[model samples]
Target chain A: MTRSVFFVSDSTAMTSKGLGRSLLSQFNVTLSEHLRPYINTEERVDILLNDIHKTHIEDGDAPIVFASMMDEKLMNKLSQGFAGVIDIFRPFMPTLERLMDKKSSKEVGQAHKVGNQHLYQKRVAAIEYTLATDDGLKTTDYDQADIILLGVSRTGKTPTALYLALNFGLKVANYPFTSEDLPEFTLIKAHLENRHKLVGLIISPERLLSIRRERRALGSYADPKAIAAELAALNSLFARESIPFIDTTTRSVEEIAASIMAISPT
Target chain B: MTRSVFFVSDSTAMTSKGLGRSLLSQFNVTLSEHLRPYINTEERVDILLNDIHKTHIEDGDAPIVFASMMDEKLMNKLSQGFAGVIDIFRPFMPTLERLMDKKSSKEVGQAHKVGNQHLYQKRVAAIEYTLATDDGLKTTDYDQADIILLGVSRTGKTPTALYLALNFGLKVANYPFTSEDLPEFTLIKAHLENRHKLVGLIISPERLLSIRRERRALGSYADPKAIAAELAALNSLFARESIPFIDTTTRSVEEIAASIMAISPT
Candidate 1:
């Protein structure tokens, strides 16, 4: 039987899910996660308390809770009943409060709203910009881009760009390196003006061959020689243009985005 | 004059950043944040130690580090020199270890790679599917979609859809309800088969007006009366069709997505 796990939170940012994911990964347990978000009011808390009790009864095991409650009274109320609870945020709050020389607002969802609405807008706008500029579509607005990624087809330029935009609020425009810009070893003509922001993406020929073959197995698109030449040329161009590049061979999108942010500050 | 802060981790997942953002928000501090990712070795730890030391000297304050290093030896080594380090994951480890009756692998980054590469591929495919089906372009894949979003212009369908696809690896296809289908009270012609997966997104007319006005100042597109009628009709359609709906007026994309997942658990 799968253990029932509850991700309880006062704030509505899916905090418990993200916080619990890393912690829970350290364990080897088969769990069914229930998200109880916006757990602010006494009424909601009462419902959750009952839900947890029912879950305990039904599962025949005390349901584990990963909570990030901001309210002290509400947390106290829940703590009274739950035996297998881990207050995820409470462990860190005391040190933070002491360090800042201030008490937390204790108001639900206040921490995020302080200066984050602007950041929220930035992310939404970045998503739009990334989509509009995907695969080198809109170069005229390259001036407004935070970073530009250059790569050959299917080297994972689009997904990486969207990840940066969605998670980091960075406007990223990605261009697939074309064979036309070849021989001269230039990446792109007009949009290379954002050259300061340009970063190249590279993948192993073997990996690209397999990925391409997955879509269509008939063409030179999956040819080993063609893929190898394309990569070698791209590497030469990256070196000649003094552009920083990443090998997206084994890295996940999140890892790639993090590496890009570290490699290029913007 | 800003305090220096570092998000230290053996993870390449930006664990430190995500963990640090939620925790640091509880305090009142002006800080410059540094991401020290993929800190898997003693050599890397030595470099980080040196960087932290230099930062302390330059800032005239011991740089605060929010660490999630799984390796106990590396954590001990870093703790020996740093005064302002918070071991974010240490407190919960004992309880988890006891509960699971298993020792954590402590092999850096192994937790995520377990069955998550398939999840990563799911996300990439979801992103592609969401893009292809966005704004009702490709309806043949309705059978393959996890959820279908119905909304008018600029109600935050595409962003929410993309967020679900990227973060949760859920394939979401969204279609804008056209005024042509108004008299019949049907949402879309061909996609009605996926009505069980349909979720209508609503927004305040005033909010929609302001948003639309930002794009173009003139036309019925931004008209308040027009927007009001559209929303009223959509709500009626939601009631008549018995499809679930969400109000995106005040919610951030994260909040909206969280609410949608709660409202309609696809």
Candidate 2:
């Protein structure tokens, strides 16, 4: 039987959905989800309850509700009628209140609003910078970059760069290694100048081959022998230059970015 | 006095930081933060508590803690410590248990792990697709895009496209409008063919002018009059073609993406 899951929150409901999906993935069951964000008022709550009650009667099974509502009255209203109610915010507040020796503001939807324009502008600027400097497109401003990523194609550089820009407000530039730059072990003049900001990304030959194969089918570029040679050359280059690097074969972009942030000079 | 805030979690601590920052921004106090992720073990908890205690003594004030640990033992240990502790997870678990009449697995860090290889690969593929089709590049494969964003420069199209790709596993392509493509009000052949997928983004003249000025300090491109004309022309085109549009002057990328998803056909 397919289960109905409702992600209810006074704000974005992102955390509710994320945690709900994580928990639900453990069980082998099909679930239909409804994302109900900005459900702050009693009117909205009444509508949500009606929808849930209707689904319950129609399916003869209560729906699961994952909520992040800070309002205790709404949480009480939701808890009484659902098959399962996971209020992500309320349970943790009391502990926080006791620990802080103060009360929470019991506010809603503050996580995503534009409270700090400076921080917001920084994120936007970083995004623009990332787009401008992507894949070695422009290097005139490489000196201004917070971190520069160097890697063979499809080694997860672009996504990692964008993630750093979006999450940490870092100005990230990335360059991909090509066949022309191979064998000579010569860095471009711009790269040489900004070598201190460089971090190399390498992946297993097998994984590289598979990823390239998906992009372009059955070419020399996707051949395992070619990939192995390129990786070996790149590794030697990184070692010769004493540049730090990470293997992206198994790690997620978050993990790789975190490692880079840890090692790279702020 | 600058308050010290610790974001502690058994996972990435992303939610802890996000929610913590949101709440903290409401208060105008100066605060410093430490993000302590993957805090799963008793030994780690001891270290964390000790650190908090030390900070309390040094600052002569308690450090606030925002936590998301699933382990009750860890929660108990943290609650006894200095300042306030916000356990983001536990308060809701009991309510969920009562409603569902089931016990939680009490697992940690499941939200971000590569639990499903298929979903993970889809996200990566979407990212690759977004990069390939960025800035009106490679329209030969426009049919493959799930959403096509059309806008003038600095209308927040590229970042919105990337956010959709990263967050929703959507293959997004963005095209920027130029003066050459304007006046005639003619849709590009590729855009015309895939009109159903197109979502227009427009920004206020003042905001667009400021954003463009940041890119090129004082050029014809950054002229306020030129930007205003471009926005008026684009809005007219959007109106003439009956394409839905969003004004991104005040909206964040998350909000824009959500609105697009709400209107766009999945």
Candidate 1, residues A20-121: lDDT per residue as tens digits?
767777666666778887788788878988999998888887777888787888888788867777888778877867665568665566445534557677
Q: What DockQ results do all the predictions give, each relative to the true complex? A: 0.47, 0.32
Q: Give fnat for candidate 2.
A: 0.19
Q: Ten residues in a row with the worst lDDT in model 1 chain B?
A: B181-190
lDDT of 1 at A126: 94
What Cα-based lDDT does every candidate model obtain?
0.79, 0.77
Locate the minimum summed-lDDT window of 10 residues in model 1 chain A: A106-115
Pairs of residues clashing in candidate 2 = A91-B91, A96-B85, A99-B83, A99-B84, A100-B84
| Candidate 1 interface RMSD to the true structure | 2.4
Backbone clash count, each prediction separately? 0, 5
